[model samples]
Target: MNAFQTAAERLIQADASHTPCEPLRDLIGEADQIAAYRVQEMVTQARLDAGRRIVGRKIGLTSRAVQAQLGVGSPDHGALLDDMAYADREPIPLSRFLQPRVEAEVAFVLDRDLDVEMANVADVIRATAFVLPAIEVVDSRITDWDIRVTDTIADNASGGAFVLGTTPRALSEVDLPAIGMAIETADQVVSTGAGVACLGSPVAAVVWLARALATQETPLRAGDVILSGALGPVVPVTTPGSFCARLSGLGQVSAVFTQGEDA
Candidate 1:
């Protein structure tokens, strides 16, 4: 197998076993961004071949804190499969992931297909059916989270699972950039942020994701839920507990992680 395919297989195995593996960079040197994306495609395609359906896409590293930590100026994208979605307040099994963390985000449900080469914020806003509060459960296959941009990109942008709030608001009804977010665990507020943390505005991140996906000949389709990255710092899922994120006008979403067996 080629190096990229070999790396992709290793990632697939690691994810299936819920076991952290050494960084792919250690096995085959460092992959360039393009090569990393190719590896991601290979891994995603394998899942598709195994009957998984693509439900949407996720944008990562839109927050300045994550960007600075990863040393990347731009955001990365990942495919969201149907199985990766959890119902609001659903209990997630902690044992099902290698190393999981949760973050608050605004999710956009698309009403129309977007495939333009240079989609703008207005275009994204127009195509958005509604905005909902979401919590992304991110995990890394790379051991100890010691990953470079390429390592994460190849590992599906560290995408794990996501939960959406029950309430949905029309895009025109809310101020995209000024919306505030508060995340709590066990009744204590753990993190706070605003929509501007996501590439100035969550809408802008959706726009960028649309344009970026267009370059790959993939269009954002109707009914697709786009996760516009994190609005605040990520909280480590070291223990089983319930975590909730409340958005200013978008309502709230909660995820419960349980110890022992998979839920």
Candidate 2:
């Protein structure tokens, strides 16, 4: 095996074990895109072996600021397991994550496949069954996100968990771009954004995610839940309290972080 492939295997082993490893020792930096992605493939396979269901996928770096910060023009993709998904308004424990943060989002539940080479935004709308408001709970273990973009990508796009809200809308009725999100905590409005914040529109983000996944020969399936990444600002889920986000026309979605296992 090549050096990157070897390092990639080691990195997968470290994260799967939840055992810390010297970032440089594993040499994740040496991994190419395929090698890095292989780490995720292995990690995800382990999750599957452990009985985690393959629920869907997620689109990351949809936010402009995040894209700029990561030096990526578009976004990256990650897998979502059944265990990693939560019902809207569910209570989550802070003890379950390395470091969790929340953000508002637009989520799509697909009714049809969208792997066309020239798939347009309208194609996404038609293929989708329902659109809902959501809050993505992102967790990173790469030491304060103090790593390169490649590192995060190999680490499964920093994906941990996500919550999709109750209210669902037909793709035909709502305007994706103009859908506004009100993200708040402790009675203070932290920040706000719309679907447009996600690469002009969440549909565009979904398209990018689809195309990228195709390169890996991984197809987005029907009934798959796709989180269009975070809109507005991301807030740390440190303190125990109620965290909520309301998307205009799409209604509300929330998660409560309690001190102990309220599961």
The prediction achieving the highest lDDT against the true structure is 1
Give per-model TM-scores: 0.96, 0.90
RMSD of each: 1.3, 2.5
Q: CA lDDT of each candidate?
A: 0.91, 0.77
In model 2, the clashing pairs are none
lDDT of 2 at 248: 85
Candidate 1's residue-wise lDDT over 1-263, tens digit each? 88888899989999888778888886456638888998999999999999999999999989777778877789999999988999898888888888999999999999999999899888898899999999999999989998988889999999999999999999989997899999999889999999988999998899889999998899899999999999998999999999999999889999999887774
- On residues 1-263, what C-alpha lDDT tens digit does candidate 2 reach at each position? 66555545655665566553444325655435556676677767777888888878888877777777867676777898887788976777776666678888889999998776666777787889999988888877666656456666676777878888888899778888898888888999886888888888888888877777666678777899999888788888888887789888899988877778524
User: What value does the lDDT take at residue 164 in candidate 1?
Assistant: 92
Sequence-dependent TM-score of model 1: 0.96
TM-score winner among the candidates? 1
Candidate 1: what lDDT? 0.91
Q: Which segments of model 2 are wrong by more than 4 Å?
A: 1-26, 261-263
